[model samples]
Target: MLAPESTRALFTGHSLGGTLSPMLALTLAGLGALKGEGLVYITVGASPGNKGFANIFAQTFPTSTSTCPETGYAVWSKNIINSRDIIPQAWCMKRILSPAQNVKNIPSIYGVPTIPFIEFVVFWLNANANKSHIMYAPLPITSCWASSLRRPLKTWLSFWVSHWGITMHFITMCWV
Candidate 1:
């Protein structure tokens, strides 16, 4: 994990590492690294073997804690996952354990509630604002479902066939 004042990009490994990257991004943003024009991207791999990571992330710096370094600045953050990646499976399990649990802090404005994650993620993806904030890359590189989207596609059929000892890329597509 990068220090609160570091200028480096904060990335994490699969599973818990992936979860940590975004939390750190939020922390840095709260401290002001992404003020109106900063960028942060977290690419999570596959690691669902650990638990309690998300809780630690959510409660890391509670609202009651001291203000972050850039409390006044806005930051841009994104989460990317491969469509066939099993690491996200762990995230799904985590969610099941805690449903409807607010993932991010919601600020009160004129008595209205604000969801920062939605605002940054869902909205940004819908707009494709210059580039997608989160990219879901489908697997097999060539299947009905894989070719169905407008995302970039590459030919990994041979690799997939050799990797899983299967003739079709369909199976691996699920983990892409």
Candidate 2:
């Protein structure tokens, strides 16, 4: 049992775990197991949820600079996203298709003709799984975009690296 006044919870996760962390935090907060002011969640590469859930979560744990009596800091959550990473943009129809569309617009540098196929797959997935009305709206927390270099090759490499490895390392280093 936790005394809300004294107990501070910091929930942190990457990728799919990122998607779950805030949900868990919200559950705990709703159950009166933790106080909103004392709860903080930091997530990277988090998958998107429906706008309604995002709104409720944001209302439950709003981002504030005001100090908490217990922790002396009152940032309820931080969503760190890599700009080039597609994971964070998923599950939302418009967002899921935007990257694919962007790729389709780009001329194939290597003449490989792979972008069309990739676009087809993305469209298929979005059509099958994404709900039109359930758009993604991120929590009203302090969010940061860790953007990679703009060049094509570098962007591609950095996207994979940031999503798979560097983002976690950077977060870990911040704590250490």
Candidate 3:
């Protein structure tokens, strides 16, 4: 819907798409095709990005703001996470799973000898943070869902039913 529109653009997605929508906005704004002030992004169950990407993204467009009646930020995007959903709260260790290969941290750039500051920083933090996933969230990230404990079997059955039956992005969940 954004292709032909002249007004500023907005996009949305679910799950992994949560990460993508804001990325699209960043790309568009970088190209000067979209106005940063007019752009907005709403994502559901979004995952986190690397620290480098987060820093670059934040530098490009500030995160959402409060003080506005709308759930949207006064500036950037908004993320929504379900109360019972563990997707947003997921933890990972990228380095242990896949340590850096036999390659230099920052290769020479035409012999000028420059360090990839952002990349190195991300790698350093990733290694130290156990390479766990990183993410950003808005205040009060949940909606009206209340806490309720279900039996072990019941929880599994309902999760699988709602996941496979309803076609939720539960592949990652199944991994757990």
Candidate 4:
């Protein structure tokens, strides 16, 4: 191990990194690497680990009981899922209900018990996550998104340089 007084640890990741951030945080915390302080896990377009995995994480790291994530809010780890991203919707869950619904939805099966829920799922599927996932604008409904796309190549490069630096704040800006 490096010297305890050397440098504090911070973990940042995207996509899978976002998924692993919390797991690593939990592991490091258990190992006392955090030294009783909070470790920040920041992510962009984070796929939802909010199901069973999150439940287990909560049991171990229960300092904050807040499950609700606000847009553009930076706290623990910011799991920013584009409103249109289906990957984030396709959750990793241990609940039997998900699998049961899957089996029931098949043509061979009759009907799923949660017909309404399935309808909701179908509606979401119809929405097409891929189409909206690419378009982005900073939250608070500013012209950044549209204007960014319309900018000259020179201007666009400047924005990427300024906003695309390696930082969680920039990551959040990209998502929101």
| TM-scores of all predicted structures | 0.28, 0.60, 0.49, 0.40
Tell me the alpha-carbon RMSD of every candidate: 16.7, 9.8, 14.6, 14.5
lDDT of model 1 at position 106: 13
Candidate 2's displacement at residue 142, Å, is: 5.6
lDDT of 4 by residue, 7-78 (tens): 556665666776667668767766766654454444443433334555555555443223553423344444
Worst 10 residues of 3 by lDDT: 101-110
Better of 2 and 4 by TM-score: 2
lDDT of 2 by residue, 40-159 (tens): 455553545656777777777666554553442234565655444455554445534334322223233223333554456456555544433445555543334344334655554555
Candidate 1 has what TM-score? 0.28
How displaced is residue 63 in candidate 3, in Å?
3.1
Q: Which ten residues in a row have the lowest lDDT in candidate 4?
A: 137-146
Backbone clash count, each prediction separately: 7, 0, 0, 1
- Candidate order (TM-score): 2, 3, 4, 1
Which residue pairs in model 1 clash with each other? 31-69, 31-70, 32-70, 84-174, 84-175, 84-176, 85-175
Model 1: runs farther than 4 Å from truth?
1-17, 33-36, 45-76, 94-176
Best by lDDT: 2
Task: Estimate the lDDT of model 4.
Answer: 0.41
Across residues 55-142, which tens digit of lDDT does each residue of candidate 1 receive? Answer: 3333432222123424312212323443333233222222334332111111211113333532453333234322423222211011
Residue pairs in collision within model 3 = none
Worst 10 residues of 2 by lDDT: 101-110
Task: State which candidate has the highest TM-score.
Answer: 2
